[model samples]
Structure formats: C-alpha cells, structure tokens
Target chain A: MKIPSNLAKSSLLATGIFWVIGMTDGFHINMMAFMFISYIPVFVCCTGTILLTICPFYFFGETKHFSKRQVFQRFYPYYSIVCFALCAYGIYENTNETFLIGFFVAAFFTTMQSWIWFAKESADETV
Target chain B: MKIIITIIASMLFSTLFYDQHIGLNLTVFSLVTLVALGISNPSKLRMKETLIVMGLYLLTAILVFFNHSLLSIIANCAVFFTLVGSFSEATSSVYVKWLNGIYSSIAGTFHRNFEDKSENKKPWNEDVDVLHLIKIIVIPLVVVILFVLLYKDGNPFFEEKVAAINFDFINFQWILFCLLGYYLFSNIIVPVKVQPATDSDLATENQLKPLEPLNEDNLKKEKQLGTVVLALLNTLIVLYIISDIAFLLSNTNFAASVLSNQVHNGINALIASIIFAIIIILYFFRGNLNFFDENKTLKNLSYLWIFLNAFLVLLIIVKNAQYIDAFGLTYKRIGVYVYLFMTFIGLTTTFLKVYQIKNLWFLFRKNVSVAFMLLVLCSVVDWDAFITNYNIKNADSLDVNYLIELSNNNAFILHQKKDRMVLKSNQGARIDLKYSNYVSVLEQSNWQELSYDNFKLKTDIKSYEDTK
Candidate 1:
C-alpha cells in the first residue's frame, strides 16, 4: 500500500513509540496520567497513526508509491500520542489537581482526534 | 446524540462500578444504539441481514470461546445483542415497506383508471370493507391471540429429572454397533440392484409397448394397496394411544423404569426415521415419480403444508425429550432435538428428491411410524417378567446371594416387583435385615450368623416425638 511519504514516516515513528510504551511505562499508564500526557505528544502520535493508515488508500491511485518507512511514519504519531497519554494517566492518577486537569484534556483531545479522523476519511472516500 | 452520550456514560460507569451486570448494560446500550441506527438509516437493511447477523454472532461466540476473558466475552455478547436488534429492526422495516407498497399500488390503480366509473359501471377490482378490516385489524388480532396461546403452552415451568439407577451403557453401545453393521451390510453384503438400460436399441430389441395407462384391474389393485396403507396407519395410531395411556397409568417406580426405556425408544425411532428417509429417496428414483406440476396454487399449497407439518413435528420431538426426562429418565445433554433436526433435514432432502406431497401428510407418516414402532415394542415386552427373570432390577432389590446358594443345591429363586422395600446381595442371596426401634444399632452388629437366613426387607414408620 503506497501511502503519502509524510504519513508513512509518521506511522513508523508512532509504531516505534507504541512498541516502547506498550513494553514499558506506556503499557502501565492508567486513567489519571492520560489527562496530562494525552493532549500534547500522545494526541499527536494517535492522529499521525490514524492519518498514515487511511491516507494512502484515501488519496493515492492504483499505483503503489509509498515506502515502508513512510507508512510507519504516518501511523507512529497517533500511536505515540495515545500511549503517552495513557502512561501519564497511570503515573499521576490519585493527585486531585493532576487528575482533574489531565483527564479533561485527555478526553477532549482523544475524542476530537477521533472525530476529525472520521470526518476526513469519510470526506476523502467520497471522491 | 444525547442518548448516545448517556449510553456511553452509563457503560463506563457500569464497567467501573457494577462489572457483574455488564451483559445487562451492554444489552440495553446495544438496543438503544440499534434503535438510533434504524431511525437514522432503515432503508439499507433487508431480509438477508438476519443471516449475516446470525453468522456474525456465531463467529463472535467462537472467538470468545478461545479468548476466555471477561471483557472479550462481554464484548461478544454485546455484538450478539446488537445483531439481534439490527435484524429485528430490518425485518420490521421490510414488512412495513411491503405493506405500504401493496396498499399504494392498489389505491393508485383504482383511483387513476376508475375515476369516471358510474354506479352501473363499477370497477371489477373494488375493495371490500371486510377485506380491509381483516388486513388492518382482524388478522393482527388473530396473530396476537395465537402468540399468547403458544407462549402459554411452550413455557417450561418444571425441570427434567434423571433417574438414579440403571443407566443403559450396554444397550447404547450395541445400538451404535448395529448401525455400523447396517452400514457394512449395505456396502459389502448386499449387491446393488441395477435397472435395465432404457436405451432406444434395447427398447426396440425387446419390442416394448408404448407407454399406456394402467388397466382397470391394475388400477383397482393399486387402490387396494392405498387402502392397506390407510388401515395399517389407523392400527398404529390406536396402539400409540393405548401405549401413551398405559404409560401415564403406571406406578411411579414402574413409570420411571418404563419412561427411561421410552426415551431410548425415542432416540432409536429418530434413527429409524433416517433409515425411512433413505428408503424414500431410493424409492423416488426407482419409482420414477413426478411430484411437481405447473399448477401454481397446488405448488403453494404443497409447500405450505410441508412447512407447517415440519414445525409441528419439531415441537413434538423437543417436547418428548423433555417429557421423558421428567418421567424419571436421565437427561443426556445431547438429546433428541439434535437428532430430530438431523433426521428432519435428511428426510426433507430425500423427500425433495422424489415427489412433493402435502406437508402435513408427509410429517404425519414419518413421525407416526417412528412413535408407533417404539409403542409396539414397549407393549410386547413383558417388563415384569424381564425384571424378575433376567435380574434387570437393582441387585439390592433382589435376594441374589441366597438364590445363588440355593440354586447350587438345585433350587433357583426369582424375585419380582414388590410394594415392600428390600435389600439383597450379589448372587441373589438375602442378608438378614432386622427392623427394630434401634435399627441402626442392629445394622452395625455382625450379620454373619444371620446371613444364612432369608430376611424380608421392611420399612419401619416412626414419628420423632419431643426430641427438642
């Protein structure tokens, strides 16, 4: 599957981050840490991964053009973002101030990213 | 959107707090989602959706079986309920669409072409009030009434019980062996019966006459064969009724024993039905039968009859399996429903190979033949004598050790069913059984001195008074 070069690169970077996070602190992350880490880096990784998976099929024609590296780059961003947020929530769960702000941010960004991804894919497919 | 948000919130809350009720929560959420989906896009679904949903549910079940996680299991259940709701919504939508399409087509045709028709020149296709009434109200009322009746009759209030003694391990094995024997006999022992080739050359050489209708005499003879079939059927029905009444009338102990036998009989009858189906298939090709005709009404009637009869037979087989268990037979988790479906499908396939008959008649003959054979076998067996002579009853119920010793000295003793309670050892010998106020103490003593004497088993009735 030939994805756009940027999307492919994003997928690869996100894949590496997920592999690391899932095997380590990212895997152990709980609900509270998500509020802080979720919006910034984790959100970026998740959105990136989502874009990488869908972009090639949605934008490119029958010809295969995207490289493995590009494909990986496309997915890595979204994956790293979600994983980091999840890990952050796990680390800072019980603190009252941390949980309230962190949880709100995580919820807002994750849901927004999902909505934006859904709309973009739906619109791209229409063409 | 609001409902969706609420549902999601509830799911998360339930997952965190009341995990045990996850299935219930999922069911409710799936139902609401399904309703929302239908309201948003009902036009996309059709009749085939039910098949898809059933397939998906089965797939999810297989996945959950292998995964063995609570979350996975609950997710599978959620999918299952969602599929159920989606299929139901699709069915209702299809029904409404068909109804509206028919109504509008009729109304439009009438209003357009007959706008100028006078009273004397009334259109031939004018709708009647009663027909509309039937469609709008009466038919639905009838359906509701039938559903209510079915719900009452089909509801299972009592659980089936298994008997404590006399599990038939030997007979079951022998039955399987017999089936294997039949399979071998068909392939190895019996030569295939081949028919003469119906080629033109062979027909000319034999100077075969052109096809003709049967003569009057032959027609009369064939009619006699039909009458014979009818007479035999009537006799079988009578015997079945008698056997059923006798079964109901028998004592509790006898009922338990007999009913256990009856359940085995039902299973055997299912096997026999399969054999009968094979016979029907072989006969169909061999007889050169033609069941179909160009008559549409006849074809529809035949199909309708077959469906209704099949449904009824299925109901009976399931009922009998449950009833047999209740009548003191063991509940083999694998039961007659499985066999019934297998045989029904086999028979239907074979029947389709031959002539299509009225559905009710087809099922009646097949199921009746099975029920009849078992009933006849049960009636001919001298159950009491078998219990006495063959030592079929529990060993403790008979004096086995005493009988063994006495028979060695040229005297054999047989014990039959008795109202009194009894205990005997192996070899048909009666051990000393003494009843007293302190029977437990007596039982604890050495019965070696008392072993030689035959003792009748008895029950001592007592009321415990003021022990408290």
Candidate 2:
C-alpha cells in the first residue's frame, strides 16, 4: 500500500517503458506520443503476464509452509540460471524468432527473481 | 543505488560486446555479475564451501570453453545455483527457496502494485502527480525531437543515418539481449535472502523416532528372535559367499554372458536382500542389542551379516567391471558402478551405526553427505569424453551411433578417427550421415558458438576434408 516501495513502482514503470520501446521498433515522431500514452496497456499486459505465470504457485498455497526467504534462497537461483543458460544457448544457435522472444522473457524473470528477493532481504535487515 | 547503476552500466557494456566472441562475452558477463554481487553482498564464504564452489566454477568454465554443450551449460548453472544456495541464509531445501523467490518476484510484485494503487485512493492527486511527471519528460523530449529533425534535414550524412533507422522491422534479438543484460545487472545487485529452518518448523514436520522401550519380557523375546534371525541369515550369507567364490572367483575363463547375467540379475536382488536383512536386523535389535551383557552373540552375528553384505558388494563390483570390459561402457553401467559404491558406503555406515549405538539421523546425515561429495566428484570428470574415448579404444564393441550422439566433445575425436573406423554397411552409412550433419551444424554456427573445442573441431575437420 501507499506505492509499496520506490523499487516496486520503478520496476513497473521500467517494464512498461521496455514493452513500449520493444514493441514500437525504436522511436519515431508520429507514434512517439501515442506510444507514451500506451504505457497503460503495456503495464497491464506485462503485469497480467507475470501474475498469470506466478500466481498459481501462491493460490495453491505452496508458499504457506516456507516463508519467502526460505523458498527463494534455496532453489530459485538454480532454476533461473538453468533457464537463462538454455535461453542463451537458443540465442547462440540462432534457432528461431520464438527463442529470441523467449530469451527476453527468461531474462526478465531471472532478473526479477533476484531483485525481489534481494530487495526484501535488505529491507528486512534494515528494519 | 550506485552499485545498481554500475551493474546496469556493466550490463549495457556486456550487451554491446555480446556478439564479439562466445568465450569473451560470457567471461565479461560472468565477471561483471560476480563483481556486482560481491559489492552488494559482502558476506565472506566459509573456507571449505568457498573452495568447493570455486572448484565447481573452474570446472564449469573449462567445460564451457571446451564447448557449451547441454551438459556444460547445465553443470555451469548447477555451480552458480549451488554456490548461491549454500551461502544463503535459508535452511530449507534450495529448490523450495528458489521457487518462493520466483513466485514473490512475479506475483508479489503485482499484488503490491495493486495494493499500492488501492491505498492511494486520492485519484485527483495521483493524476496530478502523473501529469507533472509527464510534463517534465514531454518538454525535453519535444525539444530533442525538433533538434534531431532539424539536424537530419540540414546534414545529408545525418539524414542518411536517421532514414536508415527502420521502425517497420523490429529486431527482437537485440531486445532480448538488452533484457538479458538488465536482468544480469539486477540479479547481481540484489542477492536473494533465505531463511534458516527454525525449531518450530522441524517440530511441525514429522520426524522418525527410534524404537520405543520394551518391557523386560518383550526385551527377552526380542533378544531370542534376534539371535535366531542373525544366526540363520549369517549361515545363509556365508553359504552364498562360498558359492560365489566357487562359481565366480574359481573360474579362470569367465564368459561375457555369464558375467552380464550375474551383474544385471544377481546384483540387484543381492543388494535388495542385503537392504532387507539390514532392516530386519535393525527392527529386532533396535532397543534390545545395545546392552552388551545380554545379547553379545546376536550383536556379533549382526556385525558378521553386515561384513558379508560388504563382501557381496565387492563381488558385484568385480562382475560389473568384467561386464564393462566385455561389452564396452554405457551410462547404465557407469550408474551401476556408482550405485554399487553407494551401497558399499551405505552398508559400512549402517554397520557403524549399529556398532556405535548411534541414532538413525546420524547415519542419514553421514550417508547424504557422502552421496553429495560423490556427486561433486563425479561432476568433475568429463564423462562424455571418457565414455567416448573408452568406447573408441574398444572400437570392436563400439556403438558408433551412440558415440556420435554423445556430445560435441566427442565429435572431434570421432571426426579424426573416422577414416580408420571399419564400419559395417548400416553403421557406415549412419556414421557418414552423422558426420555430414556435424559439418552442417559447424557451418551454421555463428560467433555465439565460438569455443576452444568448437574451434579445434572446425580446424580438424577442415584439415581432414582437405586431405580427402
């Protein structure tokens, strides 16, 4: 509540900007204003995609027993690293356009994993 | 904040150089991320764990440099994950912690965002703030746009470059690269936090309890039952051992078929029986055999039974080696060897548990640690290369098709030895087809596939082709 934290707000805004920039094929004057206004849709889509992929783990009450710290610290990094490597290899092989798209999605998830966990760790420690 | 900024800058720099060469790009990426992580979380690793992690990392790096095959990639991922998980504060299983982190990063972020929006219910003020932010960006953005347009119109060179920027064809590849860069930066700056398992958590989870106390009469009955069971098992095992010596060790010319049968069929049942025997002994002697004055004979018989199981494991290993020598190596054979070794260790540890009168947890912990160390040790060896080389040297029994599909690490050797190999008709055709496929893959590979092994293989193949 009350904007959660600066980090969360900034991350959402950053993701929105990335989506717009990525989808628009770089900046052009005619659509620049429109794209800027299109941040709302971009934000909604990105948020929905992320939440859709991740919310089932929570809704099923998987995290009930283990706290976030316990869950993230043990195995998330390994999963992220493995995903990152596979995506990277796909990119390296120049496989297909889908792999190209997949790399970004994998990278984003990997980065967000560390960001959220680390931010929470620092926050808890500071508090 | 500065650390985060520096990490982001490094990420951008790495992305720019991503296509330079595979090895160089990966090295830069890994080093920068490590640096950022070190700066953000300056916790010192324990000497032993640090050494283990370093060794694993070094091995993984070498594997990658050789070739970024799926094995190397997975191994490298394992190294980093294990390093981070071991150092983290989490006492839970590493996998559970990782999932929690992923879930929090995505679902938690969205939940927080919604909650924040709801709490900020003063829509007018929020809209004003948004408008103010937009206004701040709009003025500079509009000015930059006008200046860029004017400059493009005035200068032909600038105009040419501006026109070259095509908005119609979006390169998702570059976008993916940038995303990877940013993600690496973020990961380094913010280390995941893990919580140690608490006492309450352990209590809530059901734990194995040692056998409860027995009354005097029940204890007497257990002692009698243990003695009969131990005596009968020991006699049967000793007879089996004697027969093994007569049938296996005494035979000078061991047939491959017999050895294979012994290993495949006999060893499995033997191991299972040994496990059953140990469980039965534990059941009977759990609370009754600890007293030395009353159940000495039963205790000694149990010890002898364990020793006999160890002997059987040794015999199984010998048979397995013979089978391997006769038929060449396969993953299953290698796995069997590892399994036998673990079985040996398990038996030895169980014996120690009984003799030392230790608790079950002690045995569990020690065996688990031993298994983990064994895995780490195995990870150090390049099993693909080892298998390929062994099979090649024993080419009479080599499965060429299997060798060809092993890993890119084996490709160089296969290519080099292709001329000398006298393949059967079907095998020969398959090998040729496989070799051609490898050549095509090499040709299609871009700068991203640059590695010491790939480079060497390419050059070797080129020379071979030129000679042909």
TM-score of predicted chain B versus true chain B for each candidate: 0.27, 0.70
lDDT of 1 by residue, B204-248 (tens): 321122235534554444444433543453355446545554654
What are the per-residue Cα lDDT tens digits for candidate 2 across A74-95?
4343444455566457656754
**Top DockQ hit:** 2
Return the lDDT, model 1, position B85.
38
Summarize candidate 2's per-residue lDDT along B1-468 as a digit string, tens digits: 644565475555545454453443454444554555455556634445544654666667666655555555565655555545434433433343333344332233322322233344343355467767878997888788778877887899988888788755655546555654564445434434322332333333222344556366767778888889788888988898788878876775667677777888767777676788769766865554565357677778888888888888888888887777766788888988888888888888777877777656556656766765566567566677788778778734667777776765666677667667666667666666666676677666566455665566657768888878
Clashes of each: 49, 8
How many Å off is the CA of B375 in candidate 1? Answer: 30
Q: Which consecutive 10 residues in model 1 chain B have the weakest lDDT in total?
A: B189-198
Name the lDDT of candidate 2.
Answer: 0.59
DockQ, candidate 2, comes to 0.15
